[model samples]
Target: MMVEIAIFFLLIFMIIGMLFVLEIENLLSAVVMMGAIGFGLSVIFLLLGAPDLAIVQIAVEVISVVILIRATIHRDIKERADESLSNISSIPLLVCIFFFFLMIYPALRLLPTFGEPVFLNFYSSSVYYLRDGFHLTGAPNIVSAIILDFRAYDTLGEAIVLFTSVIGALSILRYRNRKKEHNAS
Candidate 1:
């Protein structure tokens, strides 16, 4: 019950944070709100009994926020002469958001109640992993064994993807800085 309540509040905070991020005119404040939302998600992950996921979520969130802050720190927000156009553009986004929730409402209702086991019956592969993962992979932790040994290639691929994304962000930031300097000169 406590976990459910905590999750509920965290979800609420995350939703509100996202709205703030979207609506706030200040870029830095928006980044900070995004960080708050990310941390809220990490907390929810921890409360749900997935500490590993929580750790990863927090790490990714921290890195992403750092990058975003760096990217926005030196920039100034330009005022638009046509504010009405901006407001008009947002109408479609609002409509899309409403329709998205409408589409997913039924799926959300089908989900099991909070704190209930998602799978009433475990799969054979899951049983095998639990029974033999440590022995086969020689890892003391079953989760470690499964991720690092059994799914080694998948793990490597994910790591590569993360690395690529970070590099891409950094390069883009550097390129933007260079372009700004060139234009200023």
Candidate 2:
């Protein structure tokens, strides 16, 4: 009873959102509508019990809306947007778009719809792993073995990427502050 009502609501919002995205003339309006679509999808995910993904979708949707809002503040929006969406593309972008969608088509169609398995057999797999593997892997902790043996390089690279991103953000912020100070002086 409740599930059907939920689906009906989701479908209604999705239909409206799709129409909004398609019918909107302004780029900003379309961006906002796309965010709405993301939010709606996030709600659907939440209803389906994927809390992590719902959070990610909400965060991404917020960022997209904020970026679109920020981009409109300084630019000559009207003049830039006077060109039709078709006119906005160059040969390079068109080729890139063609290849990007072409790349995704096979993967998107063949990919399984994402969600957790209906049943989790924790007692079987987790029990076996706990009982075995100290001799084979020569590691005391299963967590340590998984991280150090299988994914050590991946973990190291991720840590390096995080460090690099933090440094890059700090550098960019300092540069912006200095530029502002210089201009103000």
Candidate 3:
């Protein structure tokens, strides 16, 4: 119950952060709010027992926020937002958003209740893994059996992707530093 309440509050925080990002006039402030929203989502993912997703979200959020802030830091973004144009565009955007919710409302209602098994009505391999992974793989831990035995290749792929991302980010940062040093000399 406490975990659910915390998730609910984090959801509310994320929504408010999103609204702030949309409405704030300052580019840097908007980027900060975006980071807050992303961090809130990571927290919610953690609370929901998906630490892998939470870690990925944190990494993506950090990199994107850094890039956005670097791009916008020297720009005069406030002067770029024309008030009259925004006023005119907001009406149609709101209308479109309303219609979008109307279209998706029925599908939302069809979703399973919170904390319920989403694949209960269908056959899912996850059910087999959860039930018999340890027995079939002769592993003491269910997670170990699932990852080491059943999904070894998938896990290897994910590790490779993460390694590539880290190397790419580091290269970009190093390039920026080298450019700065060259300019100084």
Candidate 4:
């Protein structure tokens, strides 16, 4: 019961942090708020018995903050007054928020209550994996077996995507450097 209440408060804090990030006019402040949101999410993950996910969330958040700082260090940190949405523009924003809640309401209703058993009908599948996963996949850990053996292709695709993004960023930086050199010469 106390754990659920803690998780609920953490979630509320995360939501508030996200809202502050979106509404803040200063880019650096927004980035800091984003870090706060990430930290809250990591705590929530820990509360949910997902230590691995919590660790990954913290690592990713730190790397993300570093990257964002490097990327925006040379850019304007303050939002321009002209970029702010006028009162008339808020009508569409409110409409979009309404539709977003409308779409999410049903999905939210389908979620089991906190601390309740989930996927009760899938117990057999879980048991089979727990009992035979090592023999079938030669992986010592059940989570490793499921991710590396059962979902190898999906994991490989995600790795490929990350690799491609890194390559793309390198290429863009290289091209920019060459352009700067040419202009300097």
Candidate 5:
């Protein structure tokens, strides 16, 4: 009963937020609308009994929304230039959206039929005894055990390995912005 009430209120808030976001002329209003929507969706997730996903979504939404609002708040609100997004070519955009939905549909549908999962098909399931850490090993945290103790330096070394990749990507992207990049860096 309480869950249904929470869902109803969340739905109402989300609809109001969407309308505000779409109709608002001011950027700050739009940001607030979107943030409200994000927070409302987070609450909806919690009501649906997915607390883990709700926590992750809330954290990500909060950080990104704050960054967006902070950036847009400094911009000139008085500059009300009418722009036509309809003039832009939307064929490619429609095609991308269609392709994404097509891809995601099959993946979502397959989630249920994936059955007893990979471990069941394999020699023995690791998920059941993952907490034990290979029959009473010292590692309490499964992920920590896998990353730090077992794999150890393999994880730490990847950061160092990715340094060159980052530099290469930046170099490629900034080929035309050499002067700007040099000044910023």
Candidate 6:
């Protein structure tokens, strides 16, 4: 009961943080709100008994925050106001919110009730993996077995994508530097 309440509060915090991030005009405040959201998500993961996911979330949050701060250090943090919302403009926003709730209603109804068994069958794929992962993959950790053995190819593909993105970013920056130098000379 207490755990569920804590999780609910954490989820609320995350939602509020997301809303603040979207509405804030200051870039630094938005970044900080994003970090808060990430931290809340990590805590939720921990409460859900997924320590591996929590660790990854924390590391990603830290790295992303550092990169964002470094990238925006030279730029103006305050965003220029482009448009003002009038009373008439709020009607469309209200309509959008109504439609969003309408769209989500059915999905929400399909979700299983709290403290209820989601699946009828007890011997599921997840159970099988938990039982045999160590023997099959020789990995002591179930998360490691799932990622490094069961989904090794998928992991490798993700790593390749990340590597490509970093290389692309570096090349773009390098080209910009050379262009600047040529223009200066």
Best by TM-score: 6
Which pairs of residues have clashing backbones in candidate 3?
Answer: none
TM-score of 6: 0.85
Q: For model 1, how does the per-residue alpha-carbon lDDT over 4-31 read when each residue is reduced to its tens digit?
A: 8889999999999998776677788888
Stretches of candidate 2 above 4 Å error?
A: 79-185
* Candidates ranked, most accurate by TM-score first: 6, 4, 1, 3, 5, 2
Q: What is the lDDT of residue 118 in candidate 3?
A: 77
lDDT of 6 by residue, 1-185 (tens): 88899999998998889988767788888888888899999998998888999999999999999888888777876875653353357789899999999999999999888767565448787888888998898999999898888999989999999999999989987987898999999
**Per-residue accuracy of model 3 over 50-157 as CA lDDT, tens digit each:** 787789899999999998999999986693455444356668989999999999999999988888877755778888887788679988767667777899999999
Provide TM-scores for the models. Answer: 0.76, 0.45, 0.67, 0.80, 0.48, 0.85
Worst 10 residues of 5 by lDDT: 78-87
lDDT of 5 by residue, 1-185 (tens): 77777788889989988987766788888887898899889988888866766887899798878878877978857425344455546698899999999989977876744224656555563554474665555766665566666667897897678787779867877777787788899
Clashing pairs in 4: none
lDDT of 4 by residue, 1-185 (tens): 88899988998998888888767888888888888899889998998887878999999999999888887778876986466566458789899999999999999999987677675446666778788898998888787787788888988998999999999989987987898999999
Candidate 1 has an lDDT of 0.85
TM-score preference between candidates 3 and 5, better one: 3
User: What is each predicted model's overall lDDT from 0 to 1?
Assistant: 0.85, 0.74, 0.86, 0.85, 0.75, 0.86
lDDT-wise, the better of 4 and 5 is: 4
How well does candidate 4 score on lDDT at residue 100?
A: 100
Q: Quick one: RMSD of model 6? A: 2.8
Note the clash tally of each candidate: 0, 0, 0, 0, 0, 0
lDDT value, residue 78 of candidate 2: 44
TM-score of 5: 0.48
